[model samples]
Target: MDYLAATAEKKYLMYISQNYSYAILRPLQQEILAHGGEVKWFLEGDEVNPDFLHQEEQRLMSLNDVKEWQPDIVYLPGNIVPNFIPGKKVKVFHGFNSGKRVNNGLDNHFKIRDCFDLYCTQGPSTTTTFTELAQKHGYFQVKETGWPTLDPYFSEVENNPYEDKQDPRKTLLICSTFSRRISLAPKLYEQIKAFSEQGKWRILMQFHPKMPSELVAQYKALQNENLTFVETDNVLPLLKAADVMLCDTSSILLMFILQRKPVVTFCNQNPDEHLVDITDADKIEQAIDYALTEPDELMAKIEHFCQQLHPYQDGLSSQRVLAASNELLLSNPALKPKPRNFIRNLKMRKKLNYWRW
Candidate 1:
């Protein structure tokens, strides 16, 4: 029963945790549809916006509907893998390696778990890491398909959707991860404020959707003539329009790096020598100046980094992910690997409410 022979019968269920994740999963959903597969979508969280879902042309579903759909495969943009689900769980991952604090063999995200049936890695770096982990653990399939979220970046859109909407000055897009110790919002608010009010550069700030509401409000209060607070989950257009980016340990920077632009990071835990890292808030302005300068060496480094992280910039990653997933679904049940480290996995599953066994 090859996947190609059963293409029309294949059913895909995408489990999304946040509205922003739809950006990453939607490409793959379209790929599935193009291949004649039935696609069902489920959004998990009380914050799920029905209007946003409708705008994306996706239908809402109850948890019960998931059980009824009984998809052949379930694609997860985030890490959590539900053991209670009927389909084989696949991890498409949330973002590329953007220097987050991940435990190499355990918490740093390279840790092998029995939850996922297959892992679609972004590039050589991740593929090699997961391949070694799979051989060591002997419980999962690994595919080196690039991330689907990057498909739009390589598309021929002529101009950025936000290009005309941005302020006349060069735009400096700032984003931060939710981690308190590494986040730049609390530490550099005044500096950001100074930059925004100076009116030399247009400032657009995008916080992680999970950032504390209070912190979001605090930043919003700082908005002024040249500074705009971007509250939407759709940051792709903003990324396209940005001249330079300032971020701290957020993987979205990896997305920006694809554009071959400069990124100034503040105290990134997993620091890359290529990125301009500023340890002090007082020095952020200097870093931004350096980034906006667009030094040739820095541009080369960013290009190399993007190639290592995800080589194919042809905008077909979604199709690759679908092909790998279909291969897994067509395989025999007995051949499918089971989750290893039973006791540990059981504890994790129970803690995450993924399963109760």
Candidate 2:
């Protein structure tokens, strides 16, 4: 008996970046491979340059890759959809989008949902929100797979290499990025400086991968013995060490939630069109201060928020997502699931109201 026949051979493609996005997609891809499927990875923006494209073409042709590695299924991990190739024999295509809110116009949502053969979501709220929006716009069939990223946390061993030796001074994890769309640097810097001056805590700032060297240098210049910044390919280890997490709208906060760690979302910028309303800045700052000053209160709030945000914050979330994917694959073997009309319509309403355009 052929295992591939029993499990179904799938050619999975994932675009990787050095961030939480990769963390969310990697496990599912691994699961597919473990089940006797073929997986291929394409780095984000990997073949943008003409030189690189030419090299890629030569490599493909030299290896007779297109014919040799005929992909039955293609999986795109994030929202960015690839252009369909003519004459390509892809049997199914799966796309995953994990944003808390939808920023692009309703048409954009429709475009993305319609482009992929199957669509999977991160959380129940996101699923419901997008589903309604798609339905409003006359789309149906978006699958609520929960969040695959949170899966690892469910079963993750609490093996903190730094746990036994954690500095009693209290360690805070600060995650931020440099974005021209919103200037959070000054506000974050001010908060960090203020917290450091108290001499009761130490900060470990994790810069976004796209942040420039000069920007990091400027941050490093302000560093004292109590404040430190490190550039790393991964932040999971740091998240494990942190007593609390400070971040903007980045999805890393979702990871903190999964870990049941205290989190303070920096709401200095206006809410994006696609996401939930802005968390109040004053409230945000107060929350951070509360977490820093009152450990018990922060933990309580963390537990409550985890219950509200994700039903399953433990690491088993990946299994849920995988099961959803398998269901879609089995139910509609010919065409993958796409977002329904309800989500598109709801988003259209939001766009018309100027709530999210």
TM-score to native of every candidate shown: 0.90, 0.68
1-357 per-residue lDDT for model 1 (tens digits): 445435576878888777787778878877777778887777776665655664546553655567767788888877765566678788988887664655553445675557788899999878998998877766688999998887987875566555655356788899998888889888888898888778888888899988988989999998887788887767788898789999998988888888888999999877786689899889998889988889998888888887888899899988888878878777633444675556765664565455323
The alpha-carbon deviation from the true structure for residue 342 of candidate 1, after best TM-score superposition, in angstroms, is: 7.4
lDDT string for model 2 (1-357, tens) is 332343346554543322444555666665665677665544444322223222222222311343356544444544533332111121111212224335554333234445344456655645676677556544334665555655655555467543436467777777765663443454556556766666666777876666667767877776776777776544566777777777765555656655766666666342332222235544554666566664665567656655545666555544554555555455555433443456564553453332321
Q: Number of clashes in every candidate structure?
A: 3, 31
Per-model lDDT: 0.79, 0.52
Candidate 1 weakest ten by summed lDDT: 348-357
lDDT of 1: 0.79
lDDT of 2 at 278: 31
